[model samples]
Target: MADYLLESLGLLLRWLHIVAAIAWIGESFYFVMLDRSLKPAADGDAAIAGEQWSVHGGGFYRKQKLVGAPAQMPADLHWSKWKAYTTWLSGFALLSLLYLSSPQMYLVDPGVNALGSDQAVLAAIALMVLAWLGYDLLCRLCGFREGLLGALVALWVIGLCLACTGLFAGRAAYLLVGAALGTIMAANVFFVIIPGQRRMVAALGRGEAVDPVPGLRGKQRSVHNTYFTLPVVFAMLSVHYATAYAHPHNAWVLILFMAAAALIRQFFVVWHSGKRAWGLLGVGSAILLATFAWLAPTRNATSAVTPNSAVAAPMHATELPAADTAEIQKIMKLHCTACHSAQPSLMASAPKDLRLDEAQQIERHAALIRRQVVDLRIMPPGNITSLSEAERLQIARWADTLAVDPAFK
Candidate 1:
């Protein structure tokens, strides 16, 4: 009952997080597009920087960007801060409920670094906090020099990626990086953008000359947030792609993926500004293709027949012996059924409804098992079930046999 309740809460939080993130990101993208698509004011008003005309829902609208505060403040100005706040709040709740609550199973990987559960949770939190502080400091120190600041931020991101992959389970590390980026985005809104807007509004209300510095700062942070959108979204979605996260060079993989996402986003940004940069798209596509080729598993490798035995060299799939179902069943019972059976002992329900209590069910998911258990080695997360290497190899051998058979293939 407790597990079920927790699962339900996680579901609710995830839903709320997604909805709020969509709202925030939609607003960000819309504004960025509108700004880029704007033309010079038709009447050449000194106070107006640019204006755009658009038709939506059978109505024509003209939007204007003022150089500074208008002569009079509007009575009911809408603020965009709440969506960002809601996204961060719901996302943090979900992170706490899922990863922090069971750090042993989700966050800490003994093979990577044997951090205690509490320590792992603290590290995750600290990463998000420190990321925001460091990024904010960099913005303050190098705000005038955009190129230098961009290089520094890139270095910082690479360092964080390396640190995360080294410290936690790969899946958790990816999610943590996403969370860190998300924190920085939300903080940009809370600490810089929103505050700057508020100050400008306050100044306008007081009949004081509105300072342009705050508005400039707000624009800078908003641009940063827009660039971060695709990368952060990719990182968040990467949990589903074990091939990327579980690779031997996962940090580099993550960095490359983010670079690709940023490049693709840059293409869109340029396009919105009445420019074409096909090279950006081409470069991003090349990176993705290279990464895909790199992550493809080498299937010709030999597997250990047992824990005490050694295979002297790699052997082809055809040369391998047929798998023993009884042995496979035993291994599954020991390592997988706890969380993957019809009545999972460790969770409210079998994850993804992949019950392996029956032979037919196990055989049905053989390819999936091989990918998760053998190729990626990301299942039984954090090695919580202590799945032995020999057992994994056995599963791999079985999967390889299936690959060679036409019916199974």
Candidate 2:
């Protein structure tokens, strides 16, 4: 009952996080597009930097970018900070519930690092905090040099990616990096962007010449957040694909993925400014293709041979071995049935409704099993059941046989 309740709460938090993130990202993108698409003020007002006209939902709207304080402060000004706050809050809650609450299962991989559950949770929290601090420091120190600052920020993210992949399970590492980036985004809003805007508003209300520096700083952070959107979204979604997180060179894979997402985002940003940079899209596609190639499995000639071939060898590369059904069942019972059974001991219900306790169910999920256990090697997450490489190889061999024979199914 407790597991069910926890799962239910996790689902609710995830829904809230997704909804808030969408609202925040949509507003951010719309504002960026509006900024880039703006033209000179029609009346040649020196105080107005630019202006844009648009029709939305059957209503025409004109938005003007003010250089400094307007003559009077507008009442009932809407603030966009709450979307960011809600996203971060809900996301952190979900992370605590699903991962930190059971760190050994999701956050820590003994194969990667032997961190205790409590230590792993603390480390994860520390990483998010440190990520914000490091990124904020970089912006403060190098805010004047945009190009150099961008390069430095990229290096900082790469460092975080390496640190995460080295310290935690692949799934956790990817999500941690996402969480770190999310923390940076929300911090930009809460600590820098929103505060700067509020200060400018206060100055305007006091009939003083509003400082342009605060507005400039807010714009800079807002632009940075836009560029981070795609990469952060990719990182959050990547946990679903074992091919990415479970790759032997997962850190490099993650770095490449982030680079590709950034490049693609840059293309859109450039397009919004009335320019076409096809090269950015081309390069991003090439990087994605390269990553796909890197993650592709290598087929071995010996994989097709029967396990009983030691007695007599008469096998061609195309001739697949007869898979040992008993051995395959035995392996699944040992490593998979714990969490994947109908009445799971570890959880209230079978994860993903995958029950491996029976032969029919095993056969039904053979391809999924092969992908998770053989190709990706991410089953029994954190190697909680002590699944060995040899056992994985046995599953791989069994899977190869299934491809050539219909009887196995």
Candidate 3:
């Protein structure tokens, strides 16, 4: 696309996505904490299950709540539902704009399949839907709401990470996983959660007793959303560490990362719920993540070089002719360094960690470019980089022209 159009569209929706995400996540975190901190009402006289008092912005603020009826409903009760829904919507728009419609180079890994955009998109949607359906079913199972549910769901999520990441590129896998989570979240909101809340509201409107079961179901889904949040964030941002997605056994690495992200999230949840050191659960989760990481095949997190002073393989400067190197560098600086450089040095900015600053950096990342841009057309992002079709072909051809993975340890 023309730079003006790509830049214009990316700029606009990205801003909306950011604003919406802040609202969604901020509200989610606050409510989860609120519910957890709520205590049993002494004498059962409190109108709400929880009440909190805090000083913020240098003033004391007290909040009150209720299990259902508040004696009488407030004239103005703000609904926070749209924050989450809109955030997911904006994110979906961004995903489609940047990753779906553009060339396959940025999101597709030809290593998986040299697919046309139509086929790749179909695959992406199918996988995301499949993941959500599987997870929803797991939650709806007969015994899924009790003690074993958490463990079962966790394992099921792990299995999903392994299966889906195996079929797609690493960054693509990570993204689809995030998308799957978003879908589940939206489904939870629309199907189970919203309906349950509506039922409660209707009962209240009709002067009928609001049963706590709907509230409980809503709470269950909300908790699931909280547990799912961290890994979703991690997966959304994993494109930066191409290495994570580029590991030799890539799927296992995703499984490891997801587990690690979830474990870290759990720590916060338990801590916030006022159980600071639930040692057994915490330590057990820690060990589980550690075990997974130990099993992942890690390349140098940044470079192909080994930790030892000995190089992985001798450098072959002659293999890339000086002219070719200069041309490749020129192409990168012209088309990519804008948003992908060390400082990005272009526009207001791009996000972090996908920086490309030097020649060695470019060559070292040749396979990635080929996989993401050349073969998959997954980068230069939505053609926002204004990389021409010819340039795309050249870049891929250049990456493939390399004879071997000389940097492999």
Best by TM-score: 1
Residues 1-409, model 3: lDDT tens digits:
3655766887798899778877788888888887777666655655567777778998997666775576677678776688778877888888787777653645555545566678778877787788778877877783334667888777777776775566565677777778888788877887788888889888888899889877787788888888788778877787776556555455666666666666677777777778875664566477666755554432333322222211132223333222254577788888888777766654444444565658787787777765556443446653545676556556644664553544321
CA error at residue 323 for candidate 3, angstroms: 9.2
lDDT of 3 at 383: 54
By lDDT, highest first, what's the ranking? 1, 2, 3
C-alpha RMSD (angstroms) for model 3: 7.4
* Residue 343 C-alpha lDDT in model 2: 81
Model 2: runs farther than 4 Å from truth? 303-323
Residue pairs clashing in model 1 are: none
Higher lDDT: candidate 2 or 3?
2
Off by over 4 Å in 1: 301-323, 402-409
Question: What is the alpha-carbon lDDT of model 1 when measured against the actual structure?
Answer: 0.87
Q: What lDDT tens digits, residue by residue, belong to model 2 across residues 1-409?
A: 8888887888899999999999999999999988898889999999999999889999999999987666787787889899999999999999998889889889988768889989999999999999999999999999679999999999999999999999999999999999999999999999989899999898877878878888889889999999899999999999998778887678999999999999999899899888999999999999999988877665446553222211123344344434566788899889888789988888878888999888877776777887787666677887788887667767766776676674864
What's the lDDT for residue 385 in model 1?
Answer: 88
TM-score of each: 0.93, 0.92, 0.73
Whole-model lDDT, model 3: 0.67
RMSD of each: 3.4, 4.3, 7.4
Better of 2 and 3 by TM-score: 2
